[model samples]
Target: MRFPGFTGEWKETTAAETCSEFKSGKGLKAENILSEGLYPVYGGNGLRGYTSTFNHDGFFVLIGRQGALCGNINIAEGKSYITEHAIAVQANTENVTGFFQYLLLNMNLGQYSDQSAQPGLAVNKLLKLRINLPSKEEQQKIATMLSLLDARIATQNNIITTVC
Candidate 1:
């Protein structure tokens, strides 16, 4: 369904079609993580620790690749180290990154997950998942609105934490 004031139907595409890069993180060992490092080390669930090095250099979306929280989505910006348990996705274009992250967040990726003793998100399978995409302008509008809401939520949570 299209948002209010947006015209036409959204186009259906796969993650691989929209994201130029969809690769699993590599080379980072837990022992290599430094407590006093320059970059954040990201794992499946989120910031696992810090590292002296970074493999990625820009804004990208990270999906939990293997874990109980497989399919969880997170965004990484600047220089950061991503662990093998997470998949990094970079949009083919700049304007779509925020929208793509939001879409990934809304998706029931766990449904597509490989059911086993340890749950895992197959990058090949995830790449084929269909996505409905709106116009760039519509995407920007939606992203901006969501970002504002997210900021407000973070602020509210901080206030609640401080009060408690």
Candidate 2:
């Protein structure tokens, strides 16, 4: 991000400045998934596969690393796996909010995008990304505000569909 109105410039930061670690998910074969269960399986993109086993149980951002849906970030539920080629960033409570970190990632991803015709995200490049952040309180408020907007949009869409 660049400074607006002033000649001063925004700073560049390493990914470590904002979090504790960037960890990848577990490897599970698809045949293991029970027909219906309580675990989430994430692959190069969103929930590409399924499983009955879980690796982590908490709020975290799953950053897709190398595939068709690479740059996209998905929020995981109580229990899940990251899979190969995807890195999960578990927020470091003191510096970043879990939802807010996901928002920031969703907001600004172009810089790390390979910009290929296929447009795949780079793990090495993503892990080094430094984001300009707002204060924790501000981040919380933004998350709340956006969440409201999302809820309202969902309601509105439901109303429209009902009418249709």
Candidate 3:
């Protein structure tokens, strides 16, 4: 399946090629997570809480790197702290981060997690995984479309919450 007016085959590439960085975040103890603060804290499963400090600024794609939720993905932007349980990904300038987020969501990376006392995803493993890539222009279009749909969904949820 593909969008209209966009034609051409997507190139096959490795995750490593599409991304410039796949490093784990610094460890922030559970007690450090505050109810509310200046920066949002991101962990394996997503936003854990907030804290006074931030380790990363700007946009990033975070992958849950450990525990039952290994391989789960989340998007973070602005001032945010990514904990040790999440690997912060920086997509290459040639690719759109939003498009990679949706692509990873569809990939179901959980299946790649290693079975252990606590399942985990290794950065090296993710780097070796195969992926398909389209032109930068096409990627932007796809990301824009998905982002709009997501906004609509969020709005609908708010409406439902208000009514019910």
- Top candidate when judged by lDDT against the true structure: 3
Candidate 1 Cα misplacement greater than 4 A, ranges: 1-5
Model 1 score (lDDT): 0.87
User: lDDT per prediction?
Assistant: 0.87, 0.66, 0.90
In candidate 3, what are the lDDT values of residues 63-102, reduced to their tens digit?
9999987888898999999998999987889988888888
lDDT by residue (1-164, candidate 2, tens digit) is 32243343334566666666566776777776545666767775777656767887777777777655566677777887667656777667755555445555576564566767766665566666666656555556566766788789999999999999
Q: What are the models' TM-scores?
A: 0.93, 0.75, 0.94
- Candidate 2 wrongly placed segments (more than 4 Å): 1-12, 99-102, 105-120
Q: What is candidate 3's local distance difference test score?
A: 0.90
Question: Over the stretch 1-164, how does candidate 1's per-residue lDDT look in tens digits?
Answer: 55789997788888878888898998687798877789999888888889888999998889999878999999889999998999998888734788878998999677778889999999998898888888888988898889999999999999999999
TM-score of 3: 0.94
Candidate 1 least-lDDT 10 residues: 91-100
TM-score of 2: 0.75
Looking at model 3, the pairs that clash are none
